[model samples]
Target: MNPIDPQHRNDWLLRAEPVEGVERIEAFFQAKAYAMHRHDTYAIGRTLAGVQSFNYRRSTTHSLPGQTMVLHPDEPHDGHAGTGEGFRYRMIYVQPALFQEVLGGRALPFIEGGVTGDPRLWAATDALLQQISQGLDPFEQGDALAELAHALAAVAGTAPARSTGDFASVRRAREYLDAQCHQAVSLESLELAVGRDRWSLSRDFRVFYGTSPYRYLTQRRLDAARAMMLRGVALAQVAASAGFTDQSHMTRHFTKTFGIAPARWLRILNGARATEILRNTAA
Candidate 1:
């Protein structure tokens, strides 16, 4: 969704439906927005107005309009407005596996200090960071991701690593995991499926996918849970359907990954929907 009426003056967040491992959000917060939390995706965005401040890597950093913020996956961070005026921004959360597709088993790129004024990054992220309501088609999204992956590598001064492992087998394993994420997937089963040893496959999975196989599976399950929640599924039922043991099991991971409880997330999303409805009615 696009930004809400500024005159309303309440914290609101609008998220685009996740598409091919990419998700985008536009949000405005008057003060503190999130508690310290980490997620297994790269958060790349730009502030649209006022000061966007967050604690990352033991220090507080601020992003203003025209600056790009590149927060590495699984890094602890918290968000708030740097001033009383509040902050507005748009962010795209990209699964590291998508970047691994471009980088080809290399280490993920990282921008130091969590924020940058680098023009290359700004340009690369422009397409993906557009209004959340204006979703990208598959081809356009693929091209934008390619540009973003390369720009991230360049701006971070990261040199390409030589191909050193069983990329083909790792790819097979990834595909298998994706297709079977809703069920229990074990390392032994993965080994049998990909024809690779469990230990070696585990290593290659991290090198090639930027996360452990278990974490990857968990994220996929979380993705399913979110989509189900948006469709008005009960939390307990969503947990069961998404392969979690129970509601509390899902709640722990959900809060850890998104930095908010499921109920609060729904509230903010519902508020955004209501605001959109109001805007349309007024128009």
Candidate 2:
């Protein structure tokens, strides 16, 4: 099959032909950018120099030096230079199915800001950030690809074993979890919803989504609690609104996720506390 050259490189200076079975990019991109278009694979990249600006999820995010950008599959977004110097970066494409092999029935991992500064990802992706023309031997190439998938899941807070082609199960599982996050969702119920057996589904879910079904559900609740808390909702109401058993449950999940309880997270988030790195957006 002929490789597609539908890349919107006019926004930048360099564009390389798509490698068969691999969609890779390398560029010292100057100038500006075109409209956003979604890709079918995991669009993970790193900004080597300058600033990469992108309009993603309705916000203008900047990828300064030493930041990694992870554009989830089919997420509509646009890109441009974030500073006067323009931007230089490289990206790799990964199919969710491959990730599913690791996470059977789980939602796709979403790292907010579409940018990351994780040491693991930074170390794993160093080579790919070079000019896309730097060729890799077959084994090394395989390692890089595997490392990327693992790195992504790791930063997203998962490390499932065996991920290779589990997209459908994971998607189904994700939809189910997202819908029933506030309710009691059992593994048996999820199996019925996604039409996959329980154990494989659980394993796959953890790998691709970077968390177990329980964890994802908890994260959703925590997300809601954060939003409600920001709006000055009562603590009890925030707990109920987030589907937590009570303020204590919400506090437990909040503490585990943010490394502090709800009150502390709020303190840091609101700048009332001096500790830096409030939220680990790498998740």
Candidate 3:
């Protein structure tokens, strides 16, 4: 299959490609590339050229070449080119579940500023962040994930002891949220199911899972909506089936969560697909 080139008129090209089943993207943007949004997975990447800048953790951060940007899961952030010449980069999104598996029941590591110059981190993520196009074997992938997790923990320093958290209660709550993500879920219902009070459960969930239950549910629905939308589902039907109240409701949340409205997101994907088709035909 031929790779897609971004639209000629647009000042950016979004490469819709994945490496070893993990969503990996290569892109360049002349100016603002994203609006305020958050993802349910970790956005880990390196800036290749020019100045890469973003608002993270309530401050403006910049990444030049040879620096890694590690945005934690569910953290709100936005990106753009920091200079007139524009910026280019490659990024990989890894699900929190992968880190959870390796870290066991501990809280996910947080790398402050969303940008890091730690050599250890760069070394740990070397294989996974390679610029070449290649697939990773299962064994190699597992090893790299493990190394990356440990390196992250090391950089973040010890997290103090896991205090003020009930592992069992949080786990139960998370499981319930995952199961009923497609329906309306109330804090009262979550309390009853998890056998814990609402506020305590909420606190525990935030510490363990990194976000509020409601936000997590909204992201999950958005996740489902995105899948269906990419498969060519109509926006209205996609919103309804994904448990959103209506099309506008979904669009609002989609833009808030992903930085792009559903229609715009679809257009970008379609553009990439069309470019790929043309390239393959020419080849």
Candidate 4:
């Protein structure tokens, strides 16, 4: 069965579930879906039905079914339906750290235009993007993540031979961010924790992890907020608990990061739940 029958629907329907550190979603949107926004992780997935359109890297791209989209970290982009019939697709948000684990200290691969038609990537990502309802085992997921990382680097062509980054220092900074996501973490704190000056550390971080330290912290906070929101927590409470200055501050960041407001994202989840319930009752 077609999971998303765009022609049969008149309005947007979106469903998302969190898996580990990844966010998996199947959504159909008519007309505009989201505004310009950026994220700190790679947004990778396939276009399932119709034409999935998005603006990336200063140009518009159309993703037909079976095509893979590999948006880079910290890149600004937006999405919409590419045709009058709308579009449906599934996507997974993957942290760059997972890729770093496989690449050692090499810079993350950059695939221009944010999408690809490579069969190697499709094969490598098969297990990671399976449509099954169950989650992946730790071992299984680790293997897939490793394979996908290699496939990405291979497909993006060869990188110039360069020295490995300051992996120890960068890893320490990442751990600090993971632990102190709820609190205001200063550059000095990271510097002290990693024994590298903030300026040099920031450059090393971007070279190795694909994003800046402050942006990484903000992304971690956003990740925390997403987890809380998925549990049906109140928006105001989620904002404060996620370390935002206020609800509005969180809302602005949330909208930009996820390409939709927190309230709207929650509504999409509810809509999906309702749709599933109706289908089950009929069955």
For each candidate, the alpha-carbon lDDT, in order, equals 0.88, 0.65, 0.78, 0.82
lDDT of 2 by residue, 183-254 (tens): 777878988999888778777765565446677667667666766887789889999877888998887666
Q: What TM-score does candidate 2 reach?
A: 0.50
List the candidate 3 regions with Cα displacement exceeding 4 Å: 1-22, 130-140, 160-163
Compared with the true structure, the alpha-carbon lDDT of candidate 1 equals: 0.88
Native RMSD of candidate 1 (Å) = 2.5
Models ranked on lDDT:
1, 4, 3, 2
| Cα shift from native, residue 68, model 1 (Å) | 0.6
Q: Clashing residue pairs, candidate 3? A: none
lDDT of 3 at 7: 43
Residues 145-192 of candidate 1 have per-residue lDDT tens digits of 999999999999877774678888988988898899888888789889
Candidate 1 — worst ten consecutive residues by lDDT sum? 1-10
lDDT of 3: 0.78
TM-score of 1: 0.93
Q: Name the regions of candidate 2 deviating beyond 4 angstroms.
A: 1-13, 16-20, 102-106, 159-283
Model 3: how far residue 183 lies from native, Å: 1.6
Instruction: Summarize candidate 3's per-residue lDDT along 159-183 as a digit string, tens digits.
Output: 7447657877777787788789888
lDDT preference between candidates 3 and 4, better one = 4
